[model samples]
Target: MSTITLSSAARARATGRHFVPRLSWLWSGLFGCLVILNIAPLIWGILTSFKGQADLFRFPPAFVSFTPTLENYERVFLSGFGGNLGISLVNALAAVVLALVLGLPAAYAFDRFNFPLRRLLFLAVVASIPLSIGAAALLIPNYVYFASLGLTNTPIVLPMLYAAHQLPMAIWVIKGTIEGIPRELDEAATADGCTTFQILRYVILPLVRPALGAAAILVFVGSWNEFVASSVMVDSPSLRTVQPAIYSFIGFFGREWGPLTASATLAILPILIIFALFGRLMVSGLTKGSVKG
Candidate 1:
């Protein structure tokens, strides 16, 4: 009986070890499939950007045999896409700076102070996140308001709107990060004769750097990618942003796929470079801010 029991136990252990490896393989295969699904389109777009116009319509699509040309990129730049790219960069950077400037102080206040209606105000901020960013219903009203104020068609309009759109979320992110910090630090700073602003600058800012970085990246991306509002807000060709400029490739007759893809490839470079450099910091900040300490 003892010998039989020992053999059964050994068989169970063997089965468990085999099952674990099979499960790991299954998960890894699924993960690989997801990665391919997300990355394949981006890879294809880059390849298409390099292909000649003739290769674009070729049967079976030339994955590797096509002779690459810079003509498409040249056309894109000569068509004022370069100017649009510059406009987008400036607007996005401006939005990032504005959102961070306004959001950090509000977030700090929300986390540290207990003013009247503070909870209600924070709740409104949270509610505004989805309403302002996700909903298109506000577009017409915002355009009308801007038009009334003569803010439309100005270079600063889009950046201001983008900053406003991102501010609520930025405040939320920074507030979460601040909550994770201990009040003891603020008290210690106060003991060291730090004023409210000084404590926020010297203590909170350093600790919440990750959250700030995340907020900046978010605001930049949002402003950079914004199209509908930008298209409606500005009328001048010189003031047009990257997305609306990309949309110009869709003419009344047909699409300019080559230049479109080329411009798109160029448009994504800044974002990719940002991610490559600060991707870890953004991810760490998000993770830290999400879970309170």
Candidate 2:
């Protein structure tokens, strides 16, 4: 019986060693697939931007173009595309700022206070998704309402919509982040004669930044890529954002492939760059939020 037990234990150890390598290989394959999935589009976009309108529609897609030109980049920078990009940047930045500002305070309140209906109120916030806004069905009335407020065809409206759209998620993200931080830090700061405002500003804000950055980046990308909301609400030529810019590229006459692709590249680049720079923080924010939820 002792010999049988020893043999069984040795067999188990061998099985465990075999399983570890298999798991490691599986994880490596998954990561490689994720990287390739993300990068392929970006590389394809670059190639398409270089390709002329005809080359883009070739019966069989070709990895190499016969002639690549700078027209796309030139049109993006020097042509009317520049203004659309500016508007997109403005909209995205404003929405992120608005979302963060409102999200932080609301999240703090929900996290700390347990007053009447606290959980109910928190649920209300979470339940209010964009679908509840009824934007598509309410376009006309919404326009009339906004016009009454004198917000029609303005950048303010985009940010306002984006802020509202992002608020629920942002609140949740910041709340989770703030909870992870020890309360002792706040108590210690207060004991050191820090005011409520000072304690929040110095201690809580710094600690919660990763979550906030993650929230901001998400909101910014949404706002930047926003199409229906921006197009429906914004009517003025100067006010139209990147989505409209892309639409304009494919007019009734013909699609401006090069310039359109170039603009697309530019539109996507900033968010990618942001992701690259703050990768660890984003991962932390995502993981923490998931675990908390």
Candidate 3:
């Protein structure tokens, strides 16, 4: 009886080990499929960008073995997509820099100082979430106001609006990061005869650098992808940003699918590159700031 029981236990243990490997493989394959599904559209767009106009409307869509051409890419350059991209870059960069400069000091002040209406002020700052405004809602007001200012078709308007929109979120993230710093460090710096500016420049800034990078990345991306504000506020060919420039491919006659896709591919490249470079810092900063010690 004892020998029979021992044999049964050994069989059960062996079965469990085999089952675990099977389950893991099953789950891994399912997740892989999900990732592929999510990425398929992007892959299709990229492939379509390389196809000639004739290939684009082919009866049976071919994922491969299509004749590739540079006609779309050439048209993109010839249409002055380069100038539109430069306007977008300038607007996004300027907005990010201005938001950071304005938000950082305000965040430090909120964390370190006690002042009148502090809670109310903090709440006000918290209310400014990025991307909160709907395009339809903003379109009329922005058009009317900027048109009145004689700035409707200028490059300056979008950057200014982008900075205003980003400021609240920037303040919120930076303030949270500043709060994570030890009060003892600020005291230590003071004891060492560090002035307020000096302490902030040397101590606080370095410690919160990751959060700054993370916040800046968020702001920059938001500003870059801004469409409604840029689209409705400015109609000048040279001053248009990437989104409008991409839309130009679609007209009354027909959609220029090849150049449309090609321009889109070019537009999103900057965002992907920025994330690849700063993704680790963004993740680290967000994680560290979420937990208060």
Clashes of each: 0, 0, 0
| lDDT per residue (tens digit) for residues 166-201 in model 2 | 778788878888887777887899899998778778
lDDT of each: 0.91, 0.80, 0.87
What TM-score should be assigned to candidate 2?
0.83
What tens digits encode model 1's per-residue C-alpha lDDT throughout 1-293? Answer: 99999999999999999999999999999999999999999999999999898999999989989999998999999999989999999999999999999999999999899999999999999988863454467889999899999999999899899999889989988888999999999999899999999999999999999999988998888788888798899979989999999889989989988998999999999999999999998888788867676
Please identify model 3 stretches exceeding 4 Å from their true place: 1-30, 132-136
- In candidate 2, stretches whose alpha carbon ends up further than 4 angstroms from where it belongs are 1-16, 129-141, 187-195, 286-293
TM-score of each: 0.95, 0.83, 0.87
- For model 3, name the residue pairs that clash: none
Candidate 2: clashing pairs of residues: none
- Between prediction 1 and prediction 3, which has the larger TM-score? 1
Compose the digit string of candidate 3's lDDT tens values, residues 114-168: 9999889988878657343334566687678878899878778888888888888
- Regions of model 1 farther than 4 Å from truth: 131-133, 290-293
What value of lDDT does candidate 1 attain over all alpha carbons?
A: 0.91
